[model samples]
Target: MENSTQINTEKINFSLEDLEQDIWVRLVTGAVKSRNPFHTPCVATMDKGEISLRTVVLRKALAKERELRFHTDIRSPKWKELSLNPSISALFYDAGDRIQLRVKGKAVLHYKNDLTAEAWKNTTSSSRRCYLTLHSPSSFAEIPTSGLSEEIEQENFTLAESEMGYSNFGIVSIQVHSIDWLWLNHAGHRRAFFDYTDGSFQWMIP
Candidate 1:
């Protein structure tokens, strides 16, 4: 008898549009579901001739615009790197589901803008604590430290106190150019590529 996984695999073997839709579904779910593997994707950027990669929380995924959004500190190195070179790449993998998504895009920074304003307004006090750090991320410290003050570290700050972090808070919006989706299954592996710039979708040997 065919198991549920086999039955589900058969359903997934549908039209290209269906596959594309599924990719977006995963992305959208990742933004809201913190436990999801895709919730935090590894983002890559070019920094002074070096390839820099960091994991960031997925804040939003807009299917219609083919864009992904994430919050970051304006003082972070990755922010400066992306500002200098918009070219970016992100990787998402779900071991349980045996799926991987490799995405390429251009990132645009948003600060002191409508996007940042709205994002900061919705951000919780606990989440805002990181932005209130005394020193920027990646900076060397004399000893081990979180770069945050004791008051902020204890989550003793209120919404009004957290407001001070807005100046350092920023957002990175990635305009997706392409997506390479891979699904690994014991029976067979499937790989597909979708290019938004050229509006092309093709399946490749896996």
Candidate 2:
């Protein structure tokens, strides 16, 4: 858990291309590794005239396609927002490297489809438990509870139990249109932008 600001920035001088590669490598690696800051990034979405932001776990990253994936309950408000507006943004920051990645993309929801099926199959039972809640997320309740009855909680955490969550489980695949990378350093901060949709990459004023 190194702080990005505390890194000895003087030791590394990265070219634009090199820095871009580093960002993707870290993002892809973070998707497979736990305890990495990039594993949990902030996702923002808009609905009507309002905006919302929340932290979501990164499930997959496809560099070739410039895509990122995350899992969520289909009943959540985020899903409602995304349904109305597919355009979205995500932010990933590595304090140890003094780097921040801002990604803009269009989100495609997958449910009751091959993509969702594959993702659900690979999901751990513990994670699947979230989709098994009796009530939709953020619903008002008389008492604060996980929304699972004691009987359901006592059941074995096996594939059989996970199957019950299939209806609520979903995957959000984001087609990245651009990525803005910023790095803070003692000498001078650097900023670069990569636009996949327009096929352009260049440095920008920080």
Candidate 3:
């Protein structure tokens, strides 16, 4: 049996403006509900003149501000990379929709600030446990582990336990500069570029 079902593109047709709205709505809803794979995007940044990429869960999407939000451990290498160079790109794909969105933006890190506090307040205890690791992310160790100690096991985890992770929790807010949208179909692929800096939206050759 086929593992996936293909989307029929024949019934899908929209103007650039409509498509943009659709994309934003889908992204915002996906992030809020964590309902689709688009909720996790491949975020790319520059580290020591080299490109670094990682998948991050989307925490928020502000369509009006053209911004995307994600949380990370402050000790992660990506946090350091973003601190050194805020310019970043995120790629999101919806296989069911045959849509791909590439977002270019500048990231602003929030730590021990109002933004971080608010984000933490909204975070679930289970989710917050990720930041409770004793070692920094990607750290070398003799044995493999989740980095969380036995004392922090899931069964007894609580919101109070998350306080220990506050120092390591950080939020990344990306101010979107541009978005390249592509839709693939058996008939033809459609591509469009949206530049928020210049308020330009134009079709591009796929």
Between candidates 1 and 3, the one scoring higher on lDDT is: 1
Ranking by lDDT: 1, 3, 2
TM-score of each: 0.94, 0.91, 0.91
TM-score of 2: 0.91
Candidates' lDDT values, in order?
Answer: 0.89, 0.85, 0.86
- Candidate 3 off by > 4 Å: 1-13
lDDT per residue (tens digit) for residues 125-190 in model 2: 678778999899879999979898775665566688669899998889999999998889887888
Superposed model 1: Cα runs more than 4 Å off: 1-7, 10-12
**1 or 2, which is superior by lDDT?**
1
Superpose all Cα atoms of candidate 3 onto the true structure and report the RMSD in Å to 1 decimal: 4.1
Residue-level error in angstroms, candidate 2, position 48: 1.5
For model 3, residues 105-195, the per-residue Cα lDDT tens digits are 9999989999899888888867877888888989998887888877675636767767989999999999999999999988889899999
* C-alpha-based local distance difference test score of model 2: 0.85
**What TM-score would you give candidate 1 relative to the actual structure?**
0.94
